[model samples]
Target: MTFLQALWHYPFLQIVMLAGLASAVASGVVGPLVVSRRLAFMAGGIAHSVLGGLGIAHWLGAPPLLGALLAAVASALLIAFASLRIRENEDMLIGALWAVGMAVGIIALAQAPGYSVNLMSYLLGSLLMATRDQVMLMLGLNALMLGLLWLSYRPLAATLFDPEFAALRGVPTGLLYACFLIVVALAVVVLVHTVGLVMVMALVTLPAATARLGTARLPAMMLAACGAALLAVSVGLATAYAGDLPAGATIVLCAALLYLAGLLIRHLMERRRRRSA
Candidate 1:
């Protein structure tokens, strides 16, 4: 059957599409800030560290997502607080936490007898495997995150671009920075189910980076990023269905290709402008 037929005949496919749309919107809105503030490495740390939570959650037979949320928030807060107080060797500190988190997760999961069978899905993700309930939960969480971001856009931008000036103006730059990391953590949690922890960084950064190639304005970048992300997700989903490929890998690959194409276009534009000048 055709891709459209499959989407129409399957409720799970609808859920996958909805989840992608929600992810695209969230990533588009927050991606520029992440890139602007140079938080990509930190975001990667938080994303991979979620494995620790999954390990414990699986051991206790608890919900993995809940465990991931708790662990991610805790990790983000710890890194945020420490980096604020201890400016020395902050990169080393983050790296340590990153390693520890991933090690703990791997040890826990490895110890679980006969658990390796399903581990691939969590590590790589399969959006189609999500139930209706899981999709609804993702949608709700995305809504809450987006609402918080929308309400604090200006102050957040101030902090992101100029923390010192923002603090001088009593914009609570420290608090805002921490809050932004928390939101990044939340986004990581959402993207985890979609793209898996290992590849989440690509999904979070690629579309936004591509958008940055065309515009310097934050609002325009966000809009373009959303459109770019939506295009990637839609094309990826269709390609995966047609090619019988893994959804997460396919989506990430598509986004990467799109980013490379955008980069080339931007380079060409720059060359033309220089020639004209």
Candidate 2:
């Protein structure tokens, strides 16, 4: 069957596509700020930390996503506090949190009955298993993310670019910084279902990084990133379905290829410009 035929005949593919697209847009929305503020490592830390919450939640027979959210938020706040006030090596603190969170999650999952059934999906993503409820949740969360960014664009941008200047101008830099980390945490969760916890970092950062090569404006970069993510998700999903490959890995690989291609194009363009000069 052709790709279009498969998409038309299989309802799950439709759901998967919707979920991937929603998650892609969410990543695009927060990605620029994450890149600008150099929070990719922090984002990765939060993404890894979520597994602990998921495992514990499963053990407790609660909603796993809720557990992931709690873990992500708690880690984000802790990272923020330590970075702002602890006078310690920030990477060490984040690394410690990352390791501890993963250890706790693994221990929790070990005790949970039937943990193996869905473990792969949580770790590596299961886009082919996307359900309507998940797609709905992603859409709702994506909308909320866009709303929050819209409301706080100016102060958030100012705080991200220059915290000291923003603080001097009464922009509540510390509060905004903390709040932004929370936003990043939320974004990571939104992406977990699309790229899984293991590959969330790539999807979250690659689109924005690729967009950065072509534009410096935040708005333009966001639009370009969204477009790039959408293309990657679409192409990857189609390719995965056609080839019977792992959807999350395929999507991430496609995004990574796009980034590399963008880098090559940028380098060539720069060299040409230099030669002309």
Candidate 3:
């Protein structure tokens, strides 16, 4: 059957498509900031740190997304603050925070009875299990994130390139940075349900990285990244359904392959340029 036919026949497939699209949108929107700020490692740290929130949610009988969002924002603030103090060893600080967060999460999970199953789902991701409510929540989060990015694009762009210059021009660089962290935290929350904490960075980085190879302009890169993310998620979801593989892993692997293809194209473009010159 055709892709559309399969999608039409299966409610679960429809849920998966919606989930993947929302995930792609969130990832694409936040990815450029992560890339430009040289905060990929920090982003990874925040992603892993979300386990602490998941554990707390399980213990309190609250929504895991809320807990994760709270924990992620706290973690982002901590990291941002620590970077100011430990500029030379920022990675070390982030790594330390990441370890501490995961340890706390695991301990909390152990303390809560019957949480092992829920923890496992958070670890591996279960897009197939997303309910209509969860899908709507994802869509809402994406809308908020994308809207914030659009409204703050100019200052954000200035800050990303040179905070000092942006500040000289009257942009509140510090405030913008703080806002960026909040946005990243929200993106992490949206991503954790679909890609989980472990593989979440793959979704955020791979598409942006692929797009970067083809374009130097930030606007073009963002658009390319969004397109690449959508393509990756759609193709990956389809492959997972056909091959019985894990959805999150399939999506990440597909993105990695696309990144490789982009690299090859970039290399060819460069070689052609050199030959013509």
Candidate 4:
């Protein structure tokens, strides 16, 4: 059967589509800020750190998503606090957290005998396996994220573009920055089930990066990024279904291709502008 037929006949496929869209929306909303503030590495660190929580949750027979949420938030907070006080060793700290979190998770999962944990699913996600409950949870979390971002848009924009000036203007740049990290943590956890921890960074950042090549305005960039992400997700899902491939990896590949195309378009635009000048 064709992908459209599969999507129409299978409830799981519908859930997967909804989850992907929700994830894309969250990534689009926060991705511009992530790229603007150069927090991609930090986001990666937090995303990897979620493994520790997942391992422990698996060991305890609890929900993996809960564990991932706790670990991601904790890591984000730690990194945010340390970056504020010890700006010099920020990358070092994130690197340490990333390694330690993965190690801890591996050990925790190893301790749980008799239950074979599907590391592949967690490491390289299968959106086809996404459940209705997961889609619902993703929708709810995306709504919350959107509300928070909307309320703080101006201050967040100021902080991203000019933190010192924002602070001078009494915008609470430090607190806002910390809160933004927490939001990133939340988004990472929510997306873990959709894209997996290994590839979450690409999904969260690539769309915004592509959009940046075409527009300098944050609002416009976000809209364009969302469109790019939606395109990647839709095409990737259909391709994965048709080819019997890994959905998460396919989506990342599609996003990468989009970025490369954007770069080429930007280069051509620059050449045209120079010629006109």
Compare the candidates by TM-score and give the number of the best one. 4
Q: TM-score rank, highest first?
A: 4, 2, 1, 3
Residue 236, model 1, lDDT: 89
Query: How many pairs collide in each candidate, listed in order?
Result: 0, 0, 0, 0
Worst window of 10 by summed lDDT in candidate 1: 112-121
**By lDDT, who's the top model here?**
4
The model with the greater lDDT, 1 or 3, is: 1
lDDT of 2 by residue, 97-155 (tens): 78988888888988988636467788898788878987887787777778878888899
TM-score of each: 0.94, 0.94, 0.92, 0.95
lDDT of 1 by residue, 134-171 (tens): 77777877887888788888999999898889989999
Any runs in candidate 3 off by more than 4 Å, and if so which?
1-3, 84-89
Residue pairs of candidate 2 with colliding backbone atoms: none
What overall lDDT goes with each candidate model?
Answer: 0.85, 0.87, 0.83, 0.88
Pairs of residues clashing in candidate 3: none
User: Which 10-residue window of candidate 2 scores lowest in summed lDDT?
Assistant: 113-122
lDDT of 4 at 178: 79
